[model samples]
Target: MDSLDLEVLTRARAWLDDGHRVMLATVVRTWGSSPRPPGALLALRDDGRAVGSVSGGCIEDDLIYRLQRDGMPESPQHVSYGVGAEDARRFGLPCGGTMELVLEPLRDAAPLDALLARLAAGELVERRLDIASGRSTLAAAHPEQGTAFDGETLTSVFGPRYRLLLIGAGQLSASLARIAQGLDFAVTICDPREEYREEWNIPGTTLTREMPDDVVTAMRPDARMAVVALTHDPKLDDLALMEALRSPAFYVAALGSRRNNAARRERLREFDLNAEQVAALRGPAGLYIGSRTPGEIAVSIAAELVAVKNGVAAERVLKVATAKAALDIAADTLSACATR
Candidate 1:
């Protein structure tokens, strides 16, 4: 999935180089309740096919209509919408605030290619737009200063997806790792036990047997990173969880039954972690799935992780109860009925 996105941009760059018209759109500003936040991207093709999005379906719809209906500007340009109350009503902006967009036709992929290379190297890149001339320049984004959007320059952070280090290689780990991968998280599975470690394999994921704590120190999980203890072993799970909790990793969780989870929390308190540090741990780690198998348990955990990453309520994520789980539930119902 990560490669697919990169490929799309690469194709866009190709189109630009071939002298086919193309335009880049960025959501520079948003009002209350905008569909997408600032820094969202939408690329336009001369033929009107687009990659990525910067607004609700409505905005994309309008942009496509305009592109196909009328060719892009002869030269690169920046467009603004929803600034005035009247424009907001017409565009259906959330709260009638203004948003600016940089719509540049790429004549050279050099700029974008260079920026992408820097970003891939984990170097923060800040894209600066010169409003009057409509030229864009990319530079390193400062750690202290996040990307910003002004009418003149719209700065965006690229190649900064959050990461997840799942401790323990098991069915649950595989499931959770796949989910994390789909969510654009760089995931690694760490298990010291050889038995489980041997079976550890998932596409687009790294499997390692390094001490979970050591891995934690190395990843340097930022606010964007999360550490999940899928292994039930305290020796393995505890140290990993401890290291992660001590750092800036925003989310840390452990998998266990509710009873076990409570006990685990208690143990953390004995480790000199203040109530807050211990409090950060979410045990019984998944949303209740009433799961009985490893696969279902993994799905449950993965769904909860995505919810945390997206800041969406767990209840809000759509869950499809598996046929097996549904059948099991039905069978239980019939058994109870027969007993009655």
Candidate 2:
């Protein structure tokens, strides 16, 4: 779950604690061009107070109106919007988009408190809600498992939040860490260099002076994790890459020029990494966005990170080196024409 979903849980617990009846709305399924994805959350208090979102405000408005007029439902019920063209126009759904939602009125907060505790403790949990009984349970879950609906029951997976292990604590790393936190990734920055470690002031991310390789080992990067090397120091970056490339991390990248990355790959082969593991390294991290400053580079890196997280093919992404090379050639051509 992302930040908004987390907020929904927080607000729901608050409302329930305040002796108010709360309805939890979840986007169970979506079709066409819906605004939010499945598993997005929205919570509405009996007094019309709400947190989170489902659609582009239209669905939320309708939900509030219904609650205000009809009062909270006695039991969990499935509701949908934008089922037809006219319905889409009425709800302001884009291009006849549709979404199915499960609305459960909550009168208990014990299960919710337990689930939130597990999430805070860095545990992935599966929450199963029985629509008819209004009963729910939380069990341990895997990172790859997602929300599932089986007609009568809705099983939604909560945290162990996605993590990002950054192998540096510099300006670029700081910027990237900030964005990663906003994207709901638990970011950790590792740097053994005293100067860099002393200067690091990124608040949300955990900063460590431990060896990069040891940090990577402790992380035990899973499919839900990503590792990026921004240190630009082969001594530090290479060892970390050696471990990360062989780990289960879904995305592993390093920041460098194309030529430098080729050299880095050659250097990695001399270490403990096998050919296959070395081949897994994604150097020259980020897309080809013609980025010249630290902030721009951070954006490019975050963009590629998101693309990989979404399972986008590597070949489909354009690299910074390729774009920079094209620009250099264009500049050279223009300069020659001017001289002539």
Specify the highest-TM-score model's number: 2
* Tens digit of per-residue lDDT, candidate 1, span 1-340: 2434455567788787877777777766655767666666777888888887767666777788878887786655667778778877777784567766767666667887887777556565677766566677877665445447655665666654677889989887887777666665777889889999887768767778899999999888888888989878888888888889999987899987656767888888888798899878877676666676877877777777777876896457543333334667999999999999
Candidate 1's TM-score reads: 0.77
Clashes by residue pair, model 1? none
The lDDT values for all models are 0.74, 0.89
CA shift of 222, model 1, Å: 3.8
Error of 2 at 257 (Å): 3.4
lDDT of 1 at 59: 71
For candidate 1, the per-residue lDDT at 129 reads 68
Q: Number of clashing pairs, model 2?
A: 0
Q: Least lDDT summed over 10 consecutive residues: which range in candidate 1? A: 317-326
